[model samples]
Target: MSGVTDLVDPPRTRRPAITSLEVLCGLLVLAMLFQGRLAALLDVPALRTGSTIFVAVCVQAMPFLVFGVLVSGLIAAFVPPAALRRALPGRPAAAVPVAGVAGLALPGCECASVPVARRLIQQGVLPAAAFTFLLAAPAVNPVVLVSTAVAFPAEPRMVLARFLASLLTACAMGWLWARLGRAEWLAERVLRRVECHASGGSRWAAFTESARHDLVEAGGFLVLGGLASAVFNVLVPAAWMESLGGQLLLGVLVMAVLAVVLALCSEADAFVVASMPGLPLTAKLVFLVVGPAVDIKLIALQSGAFGRRFAARFAPATFLVAVGSACAVGAALLGGA
Candidate 1:
């Protein structure tokens, strides 16, 4: 693969968002090559503002992207996927929380989880249990924990709140899927792709190989998402967010849209979500809960691991549950919407 292709991929396809960025970038390059009308596009204030927002999103997500890529590398190395496969809970009843707690031990992004979870399924771990851990572990890992602690410095409770909400939502969704969901909803290819590896390699080799593979894959996605989000911000108007702010449900929808649109890594989402004002605590909570389970980057990873059909069916369901949990927790914590 080309060095660029080695890095892995976004979900937003909004014309205004994606198009404006592309046009502007193309224009800038063309401007350097041709000048005149290409540079004149910036004189249109709205378009100019959009480009600025897109750039801002890209810049803001950089730290999270870097951290996620490095951590994904570590997971590919020190943490053996098989280590947890053998230890997963047997019964679906007990498996969900076990999976959620297990998240603390395994390190990776939601992207990494798809590959790892698929491995567990192949290893004969319960699908429900594996899926639960897949949803939770990325958000509850040491990296996320540290990021959460740092994001809400004004309120120590925010850290604890995020942990509790994430744990609850992950386990709850796992249990729900265990009881009512079907593994057939997942694609066969995901199983084939994620577990198709020479796992018998030495630990060091496995680590380096896995890390390099994951880093390239995840990093590639980050760059794509970064550029895309930057483009969206530049082309789209801030008024879109303002409309979302007016109604509570609308606010959550906005956050959900942002979750999908921005494609922020789960480890880094806490800070980004935490920074948005005017969004209800419940909506923000949904941002946290749904981000790890069903954002754009995650959707791509899930597609690779579970198949597009399975991911489509699974993500919306998981997202709804996470939003519910976030809303419930926000109500309890803040005493209302």
Candidate 2:
């Protein structure tokens, strides 16, 4: 009774609370949605289109965001960080192809893979292979596979082409990174900040404690990106895309660049793929393949996690490889198309 009395009512102390950026972003998005200022800066077509796209993308992305955040939180809460280290091998050469195959099992879209990849790296997985898995999984997973099959209902070859081309690209990037890249380039936080520091009882407690907050934070950002996508799609001109014209090489380059800018998730990009009219089959293929691997949102995440310099170099190189793979696959397909 005396000890209990002593334990009760300890000295009061103030602790600074960390606020999430997502809340601020979500508020700002709502503000933008209500603001009627587009008429002064742009023409009606662009305004209507962009705004419509912005709204549609945000709505469309909600389910995905929920799924992504929930899955990410689960991985954070339940799956031991040690499990990741065990799953990934140490040798880069062996890890790369293995990771490509592992992608088939992970069923989420591109957005979810980012957090999961971060977790894998924190758990001491090889960066090259982790990166490879991040690139490959969204494109190869059952959802995308089924969607690809449905989108190209006529052509089993299209599905096969998307799968094989993407798999090859992911493997190639991993091998390149393993051989030529250095781990030192990774951001200090990425190389450090592991999630398993909490002890047994504490770890379990901390997970549930943090998971709710983490889910909200991630969901908020996903909403922001989705809204941005809607804005771009609705406001921007398809004619601008048509301007890419028949220049096959140029079209591939343009689509690769757009993939970075548009930041469309891997799961929905197939529909986007079906929509683009002027892009050659090769250019469209590049769009589908490169999108999951690296995009504007991913670049931002990578910059924060792996540093801006590493992001700049790695992202562009990945883009180049994506373009090449798409061209090779496209040429083979279009030759037959």
Candidate 3:
């Protein structure tokens, strides 16, 4: 047993570092070997279209991403966790709505909300309330609202429908989680990891570190999402989408699926949906509500911040609710057209 244990736990050694020269030489070798293949791959029409979309998404989302990081940093530095605990209403029922509406104050995209929500949950805020904020922040925020309004300039009611649907979807999910969610689903260790880093530094230091770490982590996932979306946008024929548009229920379903697949930024998704003139307003509304509340990129972020179990359960639930809420709100607001 002792020998087995010794063999299993061999001494660990530090990995040798690669110098800048070594990295450059390796890059040069790889480029030299792959130059012709790389050029050929770049020339493919589908690849070119995909690359263009990827660049456009990244360029469009960067400002909002930067702003979100700044806001997240500020929250970490100045907004004490204790303050949230005290400021929240005493009951979860009351707290959820308050938190949902509180999302209006933070105009960052969904990418920024994941880290902030994790931090809030770690700070003793009710998990339900924090989750509500997580869902609502990107969807109901002023920036997103303005974008929606701009996208549907002719139909001002679209703005109202989007806001109401998004808020309802978010609040509903919070209530559902409060009733059915188990503590075991959450990755509570994420909080501990955050706290460990936060404990060693001043608020300012903690703020910078948390902000930087979150930006890097979330940004990578964002790029991956963008790439996936770009590829789909280029490969999936527009006529296929147009064919799906005529049937109301089918359109809603397809748009909801596209929302998850595209994972467009909340600030810009309205425009993307609006670009498809073939889709009905109701279907577009579904796209707007679903994109912010639940998307592939958001699922990945949630899994990182919360847990895979949580995301697996929450994403589907949120998608269903978002679709229902959008349909109901669209019918009511858009007169069943």
Which candidate has the top score in lDDT?
3
Which tens-of-lDDT digit does each residue in 34-115 have in candidate 1? 6666667567876676567555545655444445445544554555556655576568888778878988976666765765
Candidate 1: segments with Cα more than 4 A from true spot = 1-85, 192-224, 243-246
Q: If ranked by lDDT, best first, what sequence of candidates would result?
A: 3, 2, 1
- Is candidate 1 or 2 superior in lDDT? 2
Per-residue lDDT over 1-337 for candidate 3, one digit per residue giving the tens place of the 0 to 100 score? 8888977967889999998669989999998999999888689888888888899877766667667767767676767667778999978899999999999988888887887887787767888999999999999999999998988889899999999999999899889988998998887675462333244457778788778877876777777777887988897887787686568888888999999988888999888888887678899999999999998778877877688888889999999999999999999998755
- Report the C-alpha lDDT of model 2 over 255-306, residue by residue, as the tens digit: 8877877877677887777776655777777888888877766666566546
Q: Model 2 misses residue 31 by how many Å?
A: 6.1
Which ranges in model 2 have alpha carbons more than 4 Å from their true place? 1-45, 193-204, 209-236, 243-246
What's the TM for model 2? Answer: 0.78
- Report the CA-based lDDT of candidate 3 relative to the real structure: 0.84
Error at 248, model 1, angstroms: 2.4
Preferred candidate (TM-score higher): 1 or 3 = 3
Q: Highest TM-score: give the candidate number.
A: 3
Residue 76, candidate 1: alpha-carbon lDDT? 47
**Residue 312 lDDT (model 2):** 78
Error of 2 at 215 (Å): 4.4
